[model samples]
Target chain A: MDRPTNQKAWFLVLPVLLLVAFSAVIPLMTVVNYSVQDTFGNNEFFWAGTAWFEEILHSQRFHEALARNLIFSAIILAIQIPLGIVVALSMPRKGIGVSICLVLMALPLLIPWNVVGTIWQVFGRVDIGLLGHTLEAIGIDYNYVRDPLDAWFTIILMDVWHWTSLVALLCYAGLVSIPEAYYQAARIDGASRWAVFRYIQLPKMNRVLLIAVLLRFMDSFMIYTEPFVVTGGGPGNSTTFLSIDLVKMAVGQFDLGPAAAMSIVYFLVVLLFSWIFYTVMTNFERGGQ
Target chain B: MNFAWMAWTAPTAIFFATIFLILVGMGVWEYARPGGAPRVGILRFETTRGDRLFVSLLGSAFICLAWLGLVGPNLWWALGLSLVYAVLVFRWV
Candidate 1:
C-alpha cells in the first residue's frame, strides 16, 4: 500500500503571498520607521526613541478613540452574530428560494467600502433621501451632521448592513455542510427543534461563527472609510474611532510621529486579539471533535 | 501652490493608482496560472433571461431596506438603496 504524498501547492499560494507582502508589509515598515523617529522638512530624521509612543499612550485623545473603537467592535459583534444566525436559519435550504437568498446576502459584500460610504452619505440627506424624509415625517429628530448620537447610530447601522451578510453567509455554509444524516438522526430520536439546534446545529456552527466574529471584529476595529465618509469624524469628534483619529493625525494634521506610534499600537492590539481568538477557537475545535 | 487641492486630489489619485496596480498585477498572475475559471455560479455577471435579473434587483432592494432599518432610518437609507440598485443592474440586468 503506497502512502499518499502531499501536493506542492506553493505555486498556488506564492502570488497571494507576494501580493500581501507588497500591499501590507512594505507600507507597514514605512509606518514603523515614521513611528520611532522625529522628522523635519526635507525628510530629515532624528532619533526620538519612544517619545512619540509615550505621548500617544498618555494623551486623552488617544484614550477616547480607543474607548470608542472598543465599544463599537463590542456592539457590532453583539448585534451581528445573533442577527446573522437568525437570518441564516430562516433562509430557504434548497431550490429557487435558496439561490435568491444567497445572491441577496452576497450583494452587500461586493460593493467597495468608499462607495458604501458615498451611498449612505447621499441617502441620509434631509430633503431628497427617502429615509430622512420618512423619519422627519414621522417626527423623529435625526440629523447625523449635527447630533453625535445620530452620527454614531448611522455609522453602526451602516456597518451592520454592509457586513452582516458576511456572517450570515459563513453560517449558511456551516449549516449546509451538516450532512442530512445528522438531521435524519435527530428526527429518528424524536428530538425537539431546540434539542436539534442545541446538540447539532450549534456545535457545527461554532467553527464558522468563530471565523465570522474574528473577521467582523478586525474589520470593525480598522473601520475608517465608511464612517469617515458618513460623518467625517465630525459633530465634534464624536464618531472618531481609532482609525479615523489615526487618519486625521497622520494624513489630516500630518503629525507623522504620533500617527505612526498610534498605527503600531493599533496593529499590535489587533494582532494580540487575533492570536487570542485563534488559540481559543482551536482549543474549542479540538474539544468538540 | 494650492495645498487644499493637493491634499484632496493627490491622495485620491495615489490611492486609485495604487489599487489599479495591485488589481492588474493580481489579474495578470491569475491569468498566467489559469486555475479553472472561477466557479461560474459566483462570477457570472451576465444572463440573457430577466427572471434572475428581477430576483437580483428585488433581493438587493430588500437588502438596502434592511441596511437602512439596521442603521435607524435616515439619509444613509438612500445611499444603501441606490448602491444595491446599481449593483443589481450592473451584475444582472
Candidate 2:
C-alpha cells in the first residue's frame, strides 16, 4: 500500500506569503534605500555611507528610548505572564461561563490599537472618565496629562488591559490541550492542584508560554499607536519608547537616514530576542520527557 | 497637527473608508456562512450561541463607535463601527 503526500498545502500558504512580502518586504527596502542616502529638496540623493548609523548609535535620545523600550517590555512580561496563567487556571474548563469569559477576554484584543488608546484616553480623563473621576473622588491627585509618573502608570495599565487577554487565551489553549489522562493519573496519585499544575500543566504549557512571551516582548517594544494616541509622547519625553522616537525621527523630524537606521536596529533586536526565545524553548522541549 | 491633517486628508480618509468597508463586508459574509455553532479553537472548549452572535456584533459596533466619538467625528465613528462589526463576525460568527 502506497501513502499519498499532498504538496498542495503550498498553494494555501502562497497568498499569505505574497501579502506579507508586499506589506513588509517592500517598505523595508525603501527604508534601506533611505538609510544610506541624503536628499536635497528636489528629488536628489547623495550617499552618506554609515554616517547615519554612527550618529544614531552615539545619540543619547536613541539610548534613552531604547532603555525605556527595554524596561517597558520587561515590566509587561513580568506582570502579564504570571497574571495570564493565573486567570487561565481560574477559568472554568467547560461551561457557559467559559464562553462568557472567552468573549470578555477577547474584547480588548479585538479593539484596534488606536482605539484602545482613545478609549483609555477618555477613560483616564479626570473630567468625565470613570477611572479618573473615581480616583479623584477617593482623593487621589491623578492627572496623566500633567504628571510624568501618572502618564507612565496609565500607559502601562492600558497595555496590561489590552494585551493580558492574549496571553491568557494562549495559555488557555495550552491548558486545554493536555489530555484528560494526565488529570486521571494525577487524581489516582491524589496529587494537589498545585502539584498537578506544576508537573503536568506547566510542562505542557511551556511551548505556548514561550510564544506568548516572545510576542508580548516584541509587540510591547514596538508599540507606537496606543501610547502615541494616549500621550502623544508627552508631558515631556518620559513616555517615548523607541518606536515613538523612531516615528518622530522619520515623520516628525523627517530625518530619514537616522530613522531608517533606528528601525533596522529595532528589527534586529526583536529578531535576536525571538531567536533566543525559540532556541531556549526548543532545547527545553527536547530535554523534557 | 493641522498641517499634518492637511497633508493626510485624501490618503487617510481613503484608507479609513477602505478598512471600514472591508470589515463590514467580512462581518456580513461570516454571518451568512453556515456553520455548526461557532467553535473557538482546535480543542473546541467554547462555542457561541446563535443569539449571542448578534449581541456580540451589536456590542462590538457600539464599542467601536464609542471609541470613535472620543477621538473622531461622524465619518470615523461610522468606519470604526463597521470595522468592529467585522471583528465580531470574524471572532464569533
Candidate 3:
C-alpha cells in the first residue's frame, strides 16, 4: 500500500531550507571567511590563508582546553547513562508516584543554565553553602575556589545533578513503552529479572539511550554558562573548557582570526564525533533488528 | 546590498564558492541517480555515495589541517594529499 511519490511535497520543505540558510549557513560561511583571514582593526583584513588554523592547531592552550572538554564530556556520559538507567528502572511504573517522579526529574532540567550555575555556586560556598558547610563539619576540606580538583569535582557534580534527569526521563519513556504481554510471557517462562532486562528492556531502550548519549555529549561539550559562573575556568585554568577559551579569544582578546579558526576546528570535531556516534548506533540498531 | 562589512576577499570567497559548487554537483548527481546503493568496501561499513562524499570531506579537512599544523601553511601539497585521499575514499570506501 504505497502512495505515489509526490515531488510537490518538497515545496513544504522550502521554507525550512531558507530559514536554515539564513540562520546556519550564513553564520558558518562568515566563520569560514574569518578562519582563513587575519585582521588588525577598522574592519581591515589580510588573507592569512590557514595561518590562524595552523597556530591554533599547534597551540598548547587549545589542546589543553580540548582535552578538558573531552574528559568532562566522557565523565558526564559515563556517570549519567548508568545512573539514569538505574533511576528509570527504579521509578514507579503506575499510580500517583509516576507523576511525582516525573515532575521531580523534570525540575532540574527546567532550571535555566545560568540559574543552575548560581544555585551551585552558592550551594558550594564554605560559609553559607550547605554542601560546603557539611563537608567542613565532616572535617573534609572542600573549596572549589582554591582547589583545582575540588573545582573539577563541583562542575562534574553540578552537571550530573542537572542533566541526569533528562537521561532518566528518556529511558523511562523507553521502559514504559514495553508491552505488558512481554513481561507476562517472561513471568510464565520464569525468566530472571536480569534475563528480561538484557533480552527485552535493554534492546528496547537502545534508541532512546542513543539519543540521550548524543544530547548529553553535545550539551556537555558546548557547556559554558554553568562552569563560567561557578569556576570561571579557574582554579588556575583547570576548568577552562573549549567554549570558555573560545570566548576568551574572540571577545576578550579580539583575536577573531585565530578564534574563528578554532571555532571551525571545534565545530568540525563535534560534527565528526556526532556523525561517528550516529553511524555506530545505527549500525548497532540494524544488527539488533 | 552593500556587503563590505563582511570583508570578504577573493581567495576565501573562491574557496567557499568552489565548495558550494561541489555540493551542488553532488545534489545533481543524487537527483540523477536516485538510489545511491549502499556498498560495503574495504572499510567494512555500508556507505552510500553521499556518505563517502562526507567521509572524504571530513577526512580531507583533518588532512589539510594536520599538514598545515605539522609542516607549514603552504597548502599545495596538502591539497594534493587531500585529492588523493578523496580519490581513494571514492574508489574503495
Candidate 4:
C-alpha cells in the first residue's frame, strides 16, 4: 500500500528528532568530545586526537571483553532462535489459550532489566536460592559467585528465560497472520508436517523471524545490567562483557577518554551488525517478492 | 508470599501499580471500543492501536531502564524520554 506523499509529515517527525537529539545525539557528542580530548580536573582538556581510540584498540582488556561479548551473543542466538521457533510452533493457535500464552510469555519482557538481574542473583545464591539449594541437594556444586562456569551458565539461562518469549511472540504473530486457506491447501495435498512448515510456515514467518533475530542479537550484544547484577563481572573477569568493561572504565575509574572511545567502537559494532542483518533480510525479502 | 507487599517501598509499589493501571485501562478501552484496526502511520504500513501501545510501552520501559542504568536515579529523564517516545509511537509506529 503506497502512502500519499506528504511533506507535512516532517512536522510529526520533528518532535522525535528533537528528542533523539537531546537524548541520544547530545550524549553521543559528549562521548565523542571526551574521546578526542584529555582532561585533568578543573575543566581543562587537551587535544589528543585518536589516541584514546588507539589505546582502546590495543588494550588486552578490551579485546577479551569484545571476544566475550561476541561469544555470548553467538551462543544466545544459537540457542534462542531455534528454541523460540519450536516454542512458537507448539503454542496453541486458537482459543483463550493463545491470549494466556501470550500474556504469560510477555510477563518476563515487561520486568525491569535490573529487577531481572536481582531476581536471578538472589535465585542463584548457593545458600538460600532455590536453584542453588536444589543443585546442592542433588550433589552438584553450583555457586555462580565462586565458579566462572556456573556464572556463565546462570547468566545464559537467565537471558534465555527472559528473552525467548520475545522471539516466540514475534513468531506467534507471524504464524497467526498466515491465512487459513494455505493450511487447507496443504492438507488437501497431503503434505507432511515438516514439509508444510518448511514450505509454508517457514516462508511465511521469514519476515518476523528476521526481525526477531535482529532484535535479539542487538539486545544481547549490548546487554549489561542483568549480567552486571548477577555476577558483577566477577569469578575472575569471566563475565566481563564489553558493556560491563566500558562501564568499569567510564564510571568506576573515570577514564573518560578510553571509555568514550570504547563506547563509540561498541556503538559502531552494533550498528554494523544491525546494518548487515537489515541488508541481508531485506535482500531475502525482496528476492521472495 | 503473605507479606509480599511489605517487601516493596512506596515508590516501587506506586510505579508498578501505575503500570498495571495503564494496562488495565487499555484493556477496558479495547473492550469498550472494540476497534484497533490498522491505520497508516509514518511507517509505510498500517499498524493497529495495540501495536502503537506496545511500541510506546516497550520503548518507554527501555528508556526508563537505560536512564536508571546509565544515568543516576533521576526519573525526570525517564519521563522526558517517555513523552518523546510516546509521541513517536503515536506518530510513526
Query: List-wise, what DockQ does each model earn?
Result: 0.01, 0.01, 0.52, 0.02
- Per-residue lDDT of candidate 3, residues B1-93 (tens digit): 976766787887898898899999987886776667579998777999989999999999999888888898888998999999999999998
Task: Please say which candidate is ahead in lDDT: 2 or 3.
Answer: 3
Query: DockQ for the candidate 4 complex?
Result: 0.02
Candidate 3 segments whose C-alpha is farther than 4 A from its true place? A1-4
For model 3, give the TM-score of chain B: 0.91
**C-alpha lDDT of residue A183 in model 1:** 96
Per-chain TM-score (chain B), model 4: 0.74
Task: Please identify model 1 stretches exceeding 4 Å from their true place.
Answer: A1-19, B1-93
Off by over 4 Å in 4: A1-6, B1-93
TM-scores for all candidates: the values are 0.71, 0.71, 0.96, 0.73
Write one digit per residue (lDDT tens) for candidate 3, span A160-223. Answer: 9999999999999999999999999999999999999998899999999999989999999999
Predicted complex 1: CAPRI docking category: incorrect
Second chain only: TM-score per model? Answer: 0.32, 0.33, 0.91, 0.74
Tens digits of per-residue lDDT for model 2, A206-255 = 99999999899889988999999999988899899899899888888888
Candidate with maximal lDDT = 3
**Clashing residue pairs for model 1:** A119-B79, A123-B75, A123-B76, A123-B79, A124-B75, A124-B76, A125-B75, A157-B71
What's model 2's overall lDDT? 0.77
How many angstroms is residue B37 displaced in model 4 relative to the true structure, after the best TM-score fit? Answer: 34
Clashing pairs in 3: none
Highest TM-score, which number? Answer: 3
Error of 1 at B73 (Å): 49
Worst 10-residue lDDT window, candidate 3 chain A: A1-10
